[model samples]
Target chain A: MMNPTAAMLVIGDEILSGRTQDTNTHHLAGALTGHGIDLKEVRVVPDDTGAIIAAVQYLSDHYDHVCTSGGIGPTHDDITADAVAAAFGTPIDVRDDARALLMAHYEQAGVEMNEARLRMARIPDGAELIENPISAAPGFTLKNVHVMAGVPMIFQAMVASLLPTLSGGKPLLSRTLRLMQPEGVIAKPLAALAAEFPDLSFGSYPFYSNGTYGTNIVGRGTEASELDAAMARLAALFPMDGT
Target chain B: MMNPTAAMLVIGDEILSGRTQDTNTHHLAGALTGHGIDLKEVRVVPDDTGAIIAAVQYLSDHYDHVCTSGGIGPTHDDITADAVAAAFGTPIDVRDDARALLMAHYEQAGVEMNEARLRMARIPDGAELIENPISAAPGFTLKNVHVMAGVPMIFQAMVASLLPTLSGGKPLLSRTLRLMQPEGVIAKPLAALAAEFPDLSFGSYPFYSNGTYGTNIVGRGTEASELDAAMARLAALFPMDGT
Candidate 1:
């Protein structure tokens, strides 16, 4: 069975400007893959409303699921909630449940529930909130789109909270044959093997490490036997195993 | 003057599969920011030809420049050259200059000039070669799009070679004020200050470190004085110097 395809929409100026290295995308990618969700595409756009809305709408329409990270904070730049609301043409207001969650957390910590903090409680009508354990700010799910925090810790937590709710297919299995032979020498047989096993995907990664040049040929598929067969063929063609 | 905008197209299944962490985007983002080029968007697509062609065309038509990473290798999955050629309605063939470069490098190193290796010499019509000092496989530039290898070292080198060939605007200047206050407490005043300075861009990043929570307020603008004024207002509004 084909896994449900998902797309990640990362919105932040800090990432685009190179002020911050985005780890959320990487974290989500790995987690989604492990959970048997196929991540087909990832797009990173700055914290602009039009861009956010466009990306959200496009991804939500195309993919089975859309995960958005960043621009959901108390600051002026945090416009993700509004953009998402606009994308779905949904009315947004401070939902009582989200507000209560924030209020309780803040009260326990003895922090002031300022207007800026309350902004985190704003949710589009009919959207379900995703829990955030690291901070009081809650991510929400509207239709197929999941809006989460940009911070790696919170984004990861939200992902953990959200993945279990979604249906996942069989996880893709991959096998690697690490050979000391250079890609230039191995590319011919690798291409032939790839053509023979059309269903399986093949990737050759060249590495120069410890004064040795080599390639790691990865074969990935849902079927373990097919992957094993492909790996066996790869090993036979390559002959030598350096790794 | 406004900077030339660029969008990155990352072509690989490894990234989408969560098998590899793509550092090339972060590297290119920082490099483009330094070169005064506005990296407006980044899209990661799989190794599929149709997807690659679509992304390349979209990014090339939308942005002033397009930088594509990955799939330019000797293996069968390395179809970036063909996909890019199709995107531009151009024919691709093994060009003499590119073949000569690879041949010379191989001959110097006593490696065979195999058929798979020769595939790296394929260049799209009306394209210029971008030198890769790390490896003999050269990347090419078609129209405004610069296609490069996926390996971080080689990608960085190709970007370094390509940036100097393009025109650059004034680099954006940024100033940061670090305060030990929650973003919830700072968002309202920061938003007001952001409105007061329409030309500058402000970003607030919350961090929890050493059992303390704080926010880093960054102000960015092309004009140094405007940024300085915005920083001044931010500092006064926050009234903390915990940088």
Candidate 2:
């Protein structure tokens, strides 16, 4: 069976401005790969309403799932929720359950539920809230788009919460064979091997270290036996010493 | 004056499969920001010809400049050059200049000029080559799109070689005021400050460290004096200790 394809949308000016490095996409990619879903594309856009809405609309229409990170905070620049709501033409307001969660958490911490903090409770119409255990603010799933926090810890918690509920196909399996030769030395055989096993995808990553060049050939597919057989063929083509 | 808008397209399945963490985007973002070009969008797509062509077309049409990294190598999965040629309907072949450079470099290194290695010399029609000082393989610029290698060192070298040739606007200036208070505490004043200075862009980034929350208020604009004035107002509102 084919795995469900997904795309990632990272929203923040900090990432685009180079003030912050985005690790959330890498984290999400790894998580989705393990969950038997194919992550097809990732787009990082600034905190603009029109860009967010356009990206959300395109991704939601094209992919099975869309996971977005960033621009979900109490600050004035936090415009992701509103933009997402506009994308679907859904009205958003402070929901009772989301408000209650925030109120209880803030009250327990002896903090006031000001208007700024209350903005976190705004949920779009007909969207289910994705629980955020780290903070009281809840991420919501409006259609196929899953809007989560930009913070790594909170985003991770939300992803953990959401992935378990979604149905996924068989996990993609991979095997890697490291060769000390340059990519040019293995390119032809690798291409032949790829054609021989049309079910698997072959990727060659070149690395330079210790004043020597090497390539790591990774073969990926859903079938374990097929991947192993391909790896075996790869090993025969480029035999490593003492193996 | 408005800065030239640029978009980055990262091509590789290794990044999507979570086998590799892409650092080239961060490097390019910082470089572009320093060169006074605004990086408006970033997209990461796998090694698929259709996806690469689609992203290239979209970014080329929307932004003033497009920078692409990855998928240019001697291996089978390296199809970026051909795809980019196909995108603009230009014919691609191993040009004499590119092939001569490769031949000289490989001869010096005592490596044979095999067909796989010869693939590196394929340059599209009507393209200027971007020098790769680290590696012999040259990156080419076709129209508004600048295509470079995936390897970090080569990507950085190519970027350094390419940036000086492009015209840029005034550098974007920024000032940051760190407040120990949470973003909720300063959201109101920050919003007011943003409204007061319509020319500047205000960004509030929240951080959690040592069981305490703080927000970093960053004000950005091309005018240094205006940014400084806005920052002064911000500092007056959220006074930090010992300052």
Candidate 3:
């Protein structure tokens, strides 16, 4: 069976400005891979309403699932929630349930539920909240899009909470054969092996270290046996001992 | 004058499979920012021809420049050059200049210039080659799109060679003020500050550490004096000692 495809939309000016390096996409890609989902695409856009809305609409229309991180905070630049609502043509307001959660947490922490904090409670109509254990603010799922926090800790927690709820297909299995030979030497045979096992996908990644060239031939597929067979053929073609 | 806008397209399945963490985007972001070019958007797509063509077309239409990395290798999965040529409706073949460079390099290294190695010589028609000193394979610029290698070392080298050729605008100046207060506390005044300086952009990044919430308010503008005045107002509003 084909795995469900997903896309990640990372929204932040800080990432575009080179002030912050986004790790959420990498983390989400791994988690989704293990959960039998294919992360097909990732996009990073600045905190602009038009850009966010366009990306959301495009990604949502293309992929089975869409995960977004960043710009969900209480700051002025945190405009992701509203932009997402606009993308889906849904009305958003401070939902009572989300507000209650924020109110309870802030009250316990001796923090006032100010307007900016209340912005965190704004949820689109007919959306379910994704629990954020790290922060009191909740992420929401509207249609196929999962809107989450920009903070790494909170984004990770939301992903952890949300993944278990989605149905996953067979996990993608991968095996790698590292060869000291350059990719040019391995490419011809690797291409033949890839053609032989049409069910599997092969990737050759080259690296240079210590003044030598090496390539890592990775075979990926849902079936472990197919992956192993392809990897074995690749290993036979470029024997480590021979190199 | 408005800065020349650019978008990055990272093409590879390894990045999507979570086997490789992409650092090229971050490096390009910093480099473009330093060059006074605005990196407006970034997209990471797998090694698919349709996806690469679609992304390249969209980015080329939207931004002043488009930079792509990955899929320009000797392996079978390396289809970026062909896809990019298809995107612009231009014919691609092994150009004399690129082939000469690769041939010289392989001869010097005592390596045979086989078919797989010759694949690296493919260049789109009417495209200018971006010099790759690290590797003999050349990256090319077709119209607004600049296609480079995936490896970080070569990607950086290509970027260094390409940036000096592009025109840039005024360098974006940034100043930050860290406050020992929650973003909710700072949001209201920060919004007012943003409105007061219509030319400047304000971003508030929140952090939680040592059982306390603090925010880093970053003000960015092309004019250094304007940025400093706005930062001074923000600092006065959120006195550090008072918190």
Model 3 docking tier (incorrect/acceptable/medium/high): high
Give the C-alpha lDDT of model 3.
0.92
Give me the displacement of residue A243 in model 1, in angstroms.
2.0
Model 1, residue A65: C-alpha shift (Å): 0.3
lDDT of 2: 0.92
Q: lDDT per residue, candidate 3, B133-242, as tens digits? A: 99889999999999999999999999999999999988777887888888999999999999999999999988887988888888988999889998888888866532
Candidate with more favorable, higher TM-score: 2 or 3: 2
True-vs-predicted CA distance for residue B151, candidate 2, Å = 0.7
DockQ order of candidates, best first?
A: 2, 1, 3
Model 2 C-alpha lDDT per residue in residues A198-230, reported as the tens digit of each score: 999999988897898888889999999999998
In model 1, chain B matches the true chain B with a TM-score of 0.98
Docking level for model 2: high
Point out where model 1 deviates above 4 Å.
none
**lDDT for residue A119 in candidate 3, whole number 0-100:** 94
Candidate models: Cα lDDT each: 0.91, 0.92, 0.92
TM-score of each model, in listed order:
0.98, 0.98, 0.98
Candidate 2 chain A, poorest ten consecutive residues by summed lDDT: A234-243
Candidate 1 local lDDT, B74-169, one digit each (tens)? 888999999999998999999999999998998888888988898999999889999998787899999999999999999999998989999988
DockQ score for model 1 = 0.85
